[model samples]
Target: MLNNWVDQLNNTRAAAAPFGEANPKMLTAFRGLNAAQGSNGALDAKTRELIAIAVAVTTRCDGCIASHASAARQAGATEAEVSDALGTAIALNAGAAYVYSLRAMEAFGQMGK
Candidate 1:
């Protein structure tokens, strides 16, 4: 499963690699999102890379997270910024798992009594 996810993520990154000004529609379409539309023309390459990293982490896409984290650093994201972003991801994942597991079990115990 992990390797499958990794291959899928690599394929996705290839799809999103930027081309030239002739056709920026991939970054402007319904697929790219309305709020983030026009980014292909407007945002700096470095900024885009950082956002990609954040998205990877948020999705818990381990392969994508590793790839984009490296890309972000290469594009000038600082160690501090990268570490903070990853730390937030870790905290959120842990919190969600704890609630779903421990809190649910606690609630179940109360109901059974």
Candidate 2:
């Protein structure tokens, strides 16, 4: 395993407690945002969790990955589904890099002029 996700989740929550205490308003707002996502009922929990996992991977957020991975499992997402989501993340990252590479080439050509 890449990480002890369960332990990481526990450790993350422990570490966040003080920060949340210090910024109660921010924490509450964040919680409210999360609640709002579910309130729409447009997507089921499993789909939301899968999307969260993909976003976490794309954003390179370990804490979010751990949290959403567990939630995905709880929401009955299969391993294959998670793998497919990861593949999407990989493609997106590569596509972003490709686009940035084009920008870099453009900047390099501009520098020559």
Best by lDDT: 2
Q: What is the Å distance of residue 81 in model 2 from its true position?
A: 0.5
Give the alpha-carbon lDDT of every model.
Answer: 0.69, 0.93
Error of 2 at 27 (Å): 0.9
Q: Candidate 2 has which clashing residue pairs, if any? A: none
lDDT of 2 by residue, 1-113 (tens): 77999998899889878989899999989888987887878989999999999999999899999999999999999999999998999999999999999999999999999
> In model 1, where do residues sit more than 4 Å from their true spots?
1-10, 15-30, 34-55, 110-113
Cα error of candidate 2 at position 79, Å: 0.3
Give the C-alpha miss distance for residue 11 in model 2, angstroms. Answer: 0.8
Error of 1 at 54 (Å): 4.4
Per-candidate TM-score against the hidden true structure: 0.47, 0.93
